[model samples]
Target: MMTTPARIRVAIQIPPSRADYAAIRRAAAQADALGADAIFNWDHFFPLGKDTSGKHFECWTMLGAWAESTSHAAIGALVSCVAYRNPDLLADMARTVDHVSDGRLILGLGAGFREWEAKEYGFEFGSPAQRVQQLGEALHRIERRMTLLNPGPVRKLPILVAADGAKALRLVARYADIWQTFAEDDAFSEKSRLLDSYCDQLQRDPATIERAVFVDGDPWTVGTRLRERGAGMFTLMTRGPDFNLDGLRRWLAWRDEHNAQASRS
Candidate 1:
């Protein structure tokens, strides 16, 4: 039961798969200019779905570029895999990006689930429980590193945890400023209730954690329903080739209307 905001904010995830670096950069900049609250990219080494071997750029590298290119929207990985890099190094990279963006960066992290990525990169794939445990340790190390780094982060960088499992939810309760997941209908409601229970047990005010979810389909029909289900941040995924903004435009319009109503109230 997080404190609901009057207007729902929207993020757009521009997948780097099968697209040129120039196209990806343009899409991110355009999304920011079009009033996106955040612009995100995934942490996979290869393209997801259809063309697994397609041209795909690295996540953190693109984020660095986005930091300098976008003027308004916060930029980050939709969720970076904890297994991919050393926690301390990840923290430093995030800190640098924060500086580059002038403090507009969200550090989104998760226990990675891609076996191919680990296998190809020579990193340990590990079991789900093991990865979750690693993620917890990584979170602790990241926090410590953020403090130890010279000059430190531009601000107390906001951490977004992407998780749905019970163990991961506990970590989210303990550390996350924003909790993100992809669920809908009854499953979405149930997961949210479980998160609230975790917050209560941890003596945390649920309102302190912002709720986010990935959205597909029409904003007016689907987005409103998700907002009602306690998702304040809605993220839409746009794949490359031609990073479409038509849908994003419609959602931004919805956001504007919703916020205006809130102001009146």
Candidate 2:
């Protein structure tokens, strides 16, 4: 396992589905106020899960609002679909949001999946490999555009790549500051080890990339085990209608305890 001394960070992803934008906004603000290191929303045109036809909002626009709404926590999409917008335009949007948040934006990106949504939106739902190749190209364009922009980003905006496959892991090794995946326990450990191998081939320090995973169980239980296996950032998913933050509070407590221990060590 890749070793690092970084303190653990907690993020809360507020799914903007099945609820009004006002409720989503309140949840984002609340998560930030509750000491979440980052707040995120998923990028999708329609609602996910059982209530697929329910109300939902766009990702970047909501991020702009979140930029203004919260003061401390960083904010962005959990993973913005790369196929949804032109890379250069997306770069400009990220730069603008970074300014709005005073440099608290983490651009989480992924190759687009969900063929049904792609067909509805008139995007070509290419094969999985093709889409990942496209994502690699988009990342290059985004980095280029960031440099060309006149004022540029207020800070070195971190890029978070959400991927798990071999090619995707290669891109993560090359471009990501934070690498996030949803695998649990052994699956997560295996993928993380593969990521380290990819980083080794690229001559990049594996520990330079923060490893993040979705917390599916009790934070103290699942999260502690993942932390032991080299993951440092844990993201809790909360869905709207109510966007309950009880879980986030518990996870934040776990984060505090973990960070305190790291500092003491």
Q: Each candidate's lDDT (Cα)?
A: 0.90, 0.91
lDDT of 2 by residue, 18-131 (tens): 899889889988899999999999999898876579998899999999999999999999899999899999999999999999999999999977899988989887899999
Using lDDT, give the best candidate's number.
2
Estimate the lDDT of model 1. 0.90
Candidate 1 local lDDT, 120-184, one digit each (tens): 98999889999999999999999999989998988899999999999999999999999999778
For model 2, the superposed segments whose C-alpha errors exceed 4 Å read: none
Q: How many residue pairs clash in each candidate?
A: 1, 0
lDDT (Cα, 0-100) at 151 in candidate 2: 88
Worst 10 residues of 1 by lDDT: 1-10
